[model samples]
Target: MTAFVLVSGMFTGTHVWRETAARLTAAGAEAHTVALTGLDGPCTAPAGGIDLETHIADVLTVIDSVGTAQDREVVLVGHDYGIHPALGAADRRAERVGRVVHLDSGMPQDGVPALAAVPDRSLRARLAAAGGRADTGDVLKPPAGADEWRLWGSTAGVPDATLDRLTALAAPQPLATLLQPLSLTGAVATVPTTGVLCTRNGASIETVQMMVGFGDPALQALTDPRVTFFELPTGHWPMLSAPAELTDVLLRAAAGEGHRLVPADAAVPPAHLRPFPLDVPEALRERHGNVDLHLPDADGPRPAVLFVHGGPVPADARPTPRDWPTLTGYARLAAAGGAVGAVVDHRLHDLSDYERAAADVAAAVEAVRADPAVDADRVALWFFSGAGLITTDWLAAPPRWLRCLAATYPVLAPLPAWGLSGSRFHPARAVADAGDLPLVLTRVGLEAPEIAATVEEFLAAAEDAGADVEVVDVPHGHHAFEGVDPTDETREAVQRAMRAVLDRVGRHGAP
Candidate 1:
């Protein structure tokens, strides 16, 4: 059986994990909870007696007592303040721990204590007043009652009963746990780690990386080769507010499943995939382009599809919010079929910016091809909606290395009603110029009459020009039908189209 050890945060003990542990136990797994030293009860250890090392020992003791088996796996789960001790212990007893999960918690650096990372002065003062110093009693606690919990933002999504229990059971945290600096020799770095972020505050891996510099050691730890990231829509204490979901995530983590940040209905096909951020220069992130990559689980020289998303072009001047789940899901589907998937964000202020967008696409394609993990010659382009207009340049004179291309409900011809002029961007004009390059076009039957007309006209032009084109029609589908309302039909449609694209591309054809 797999062993799951749960470590709770400041002022809270294993009592907070009752629901989560029960669920894990019910699922036939061994669940152990840790109540660290000094905070076990009132004055168990003198205020000044306990420090970071003491807690680390406490965690190690629990791991040792659990015993071990060759086939059995030991997973250490740490939340908030508890993360430091759990990770520290894992670093020391690296062989005993198989995996570590950090739930809405801060990671520890060798010389940095948990306190140094806190920026709120008022909170720091409150902590100091509660005994976080040498002269102080060395313990910190949340003020009593439900009102305080709400005011401190700790009660979000938490039930009244759980909140009351937490308030009553909460203990004073040992100040040293925050004040003492943590140290590591990189041993724990090898242990697989997963971060489950509570998204109630709208925080994501990208946002966090932006908040903390991309080079921060803590952030680097989160993206380590063995690490996978997950997001929970509820508040920080998922064990209390979202126990079932939290337990499910823990089970998946123990089983070594990869990332799954999408919603339940997002229809993301299962595949071994990893986040692959392109190394775009900071100078180009603003006006030029930005891209996100999802590579197949298999190693080196895999086929790849460079995706370009549809757009009307956001006028807000800020970066457009990309639907990461959908992008990753598409990539995963492609990965499942034995190819790497990439989503590129290019300049899209208006239809007039096609040239600039095309340049971005070209740059993104080069980057994907240059990746050691990708088969440079086996590359294809996939475009969706408005972004399909940019395909005009590709369809005009297909490159020798460009294997094939696919488009969905594309705006092949510019619509004057939408500020697009045929003279500026028109894929129909390029169809006649398209050579023997194979192409796949998906037409959504329920699409706007104008778009349907465009699809018909483009198909006719291409066929008349002797272009090798294949058309797949979704009878009752609308634009972005799957994302509009994911269903059995839409799901299967997407899978079918992806499979067809991979097969026709002749690049590592996906099964």
Candidate 2:
């Protein structure tokens, strides 16, 4: 028999797990819902007195009381903020834990506080400004109403009554709980782990696999056989939105039955570090701050293409995008033809960095146009990956000097859980504003579902608005196809996209 211990996240208690726990019990599993100090059940601790240690002890007490008799397996399931304490306890009692389930939460590293996981950008910024330190009397209040639930996590698929109850029963989180850094002795590393992704809450299993391909040393552990993944279609609170499904997933997870990600080949270079597919000759290059210019061999002024790389790339990613072979290859290909090529590095370290990144790209364009080697009036902008969101600005207000725009595997619209609704970055809606500006879009058949949906949405909007758009299709390519899918079709798609964009700039610029 499997004994399950449930730990709820911030601003809620075991009350939040009532439905799911009942289902688990009905399914013949022993379910014990933990009531963190100050959040649920009877609490003798004063306001702000319950730090992470208090909650860690709370979960540990429950684990101890559940007992390991009859050789029963104990599964510790942590949801959101609850993962901190759950991890804290599991780290200390790794031998006793059969499995540790990360339910809709990131793998928190040692020395990071729970505040780092809070989804509200403004709230996180405000708390960061205070150094995540609060007085003994201070506490973080939960969302005040139904509309504010998004301030925490996506409320998709959750019924209206559940949202109301959640708001009404929400507890003020102790400031200390979030402020304290999680300390791990590394014992939990050996324990079997399962990641339960809440797709509508901003992450999917595919995204996780994509990140693992980035070759980040820290994320390499996810490739371990001991780690598995399960995705829930609902939002953050699966207990309320999809209790039965959540219970089923949990049971399967405990049984060690879930999908495992294929480990990236250690012998091959990471996707980003691989050589660019095309073999174009190098161009005369110059760097100005964050931008790199690859000049055409000809002396006379020429048309230019400014390439914008995709991101939410880690701020510390080595070699940067401008130095990457893919960007440099595209730039050199443009230069080898008849035009100058330019690449710019923008600060898009987080989803909220779009506005700032857009500003950076705009600044880079002005710098590129001002160069004596390039024709200011015949410049095209080409975007890649997440940078696709930044294209909305250009699409909404195309200047006369801007000749053409190109996007490759771009995310034209924000994901549902990104909380970017009504933002200026919706290229699908903004496409209607693009009057006479030519758009060259290169789409891959094997693109991730969420990203592909955005491209389709943009295409539909473009068709509805009668926008001038040209599409180059790679029927078997994946996102970042240059490195991942190096086929004749991939090379042809790249060349075709280059020709289409450069032709609009009054030159044939494909090598």
Candidate 3:
């Protein structure tokens, strides 16, 4: 007999698990839902406000009572913020837990507080300002309205009635529960783990596997046989949107019957770290602060292409984007074609860093144009991946020197979870303002659904505005296909995009 313990994320409590728990019970499994202090039910928060430890203890009590009485270990399932307390409890009583399931949540590391999970930027800033101190008596309130539900997580596929009920029953979460760092003795590492990804909420099984393929030491542990994965087609709140499906996944996860990710090949370098697909002779390089200029062999003042690498890349990422093979390869390719290739390193370490990143890129462009070896009157800005958002500014108002704009596997619109609904970085919306500025976009067939949706949105906008846009298709390519999928199609698309940009740059006396 399998005993399943459920823990609901921030705001609501055991009540949120009603449908899923009932389904589990009907399936002949023992279902127990935990009510964290100050959340749902009659449990009042103790003086000084309940912290993470209090919630950990709350889960521990249930685990002990159920495990002892039934004489069986339980499968602990934690959803969203609920994963914190569940992990803390599991760490403390690893022997009593059969498996730990992470439902639509990130893997919380030791010493990191649950506050990192808070999705609202304003709310996060406020909590950080208060220092999450219990003495501050700060309580983070749940989303008050229907529209605000997305601040917590994606509400895709969730019914209006469910959203109303969730909003009504949502409780105020103590700052302490979010502030206190999770403590672990490392005992839970040996426990079999299962991850339940919510695709519409921005994460999917494929993304996770791709990250693992990055050769990131931190993510390599996920390739372990003990770590299995299951993906839900719904959003963050699976219990409300697809209770039956959630129940089914949970049952299979408990049985150790989920998908396993293949370990990355040790011989081949990680996709991003791999050599660029194109083969071009290296160009003479000169560094100008954050920007690196790859000069063509032929001298007299040549046109330049400023390449902006995509990110939300970690501040401490190795080799930086300027040094990456793909960027350098493109730079070399541009130089080989009689144009100076300029790669710039920007501060796009977080989603919020787009403004600073744009400033850095603008500065880089000026530096490239000011160089004696480059033609100041002819320049093209090429963006990649997330860097595509920065193109909004250039697209809205094109300068005479700006010949063309190119993007490869770009994110033209912000995803729902990013909370950037009305921001200035929306290139899809900004495309309407682009008047006759030539635009080139290289789209991959195997791109992530969310990113692909943004590309589609941008294409529709471009069509409506009658913008001079040329679409280059990589039929069987994936995002970052330059290094990941090295096929003839990928090579042809790359060369085609280069020719289009250079052709625009070659035009004399541009408008």
Highest lDDT, which number? 2
TM-score: the better of candidates 1 and 3: 3
- Each model's lDDT comes to 0.70, 0.87, 0.87
Candidate number achieving the greatest TM-score relative to the actual structure = 3
Query: Per-candidate TM vs. native?
Result: 0.50, 0.86, 0.91
Q: Which tens-of-lDDT digit does each residue in 18-41 have in candidate 2?
A: 999999999999999998888884
Residue-level lDDT for 175 in candidate 1: 74
1-511 per-residue lDDT for model 3 (tens digits) = 8899999998888988899999999999989999888888533333456889999999999998884654565999999899999999999888889999999987899999998877766677677788834562457667787787886788988899888888888887877888899998899897899999988877778767756664456777888888999988788899999999999999999888898876766666666778888888999999989999998988588899999998777666677789999999999999998899999999997777888999999999899989998889999999999899999999999988898999999999887666566468899999999999999999999998888989999999999999999999998999899989988999999999999999988733332
Report residue 212 deviation for candidate 3 (angstroms): 3.5
lDDT of 1 by residue, 1-511 (tens): 7899899877777788899999999999989999787666542434567888888998999998898777778899998778989999999889989999988776677887876434233465465565433543556655488765543333458888877777777777667677888989889988988888776522345334332221233343444457777778676678989999999989988887756333212244211111222211111011124666565656567788887876644434223423344555676677767677777767765444666788888899898888777788788899887787888888998887777889987878754223244244678879888899889888898876556666788888998999998787788776666545456666666777787878865544342
- Model 3: how large is the Cα RMSD against the reference? 2.9
- Please identify model 1 stretches exceeding 4 Å from their true place: 41-47, 117-120, 125-133, 150-154, 209-221, 260-511
Alpha carbon deviation, residue 386, candidate 2 (Å): 1.6
Give the TM-score ranking, best first: 3, 2, 1
The collision pairs in model 1 are none
TM-score of model 1 relative to the true fold? 0.50
**Candidate 2 total steric clashes:** 0
Which window of 10 residues has the lowest lDDT sum in candidate 3? 41-50
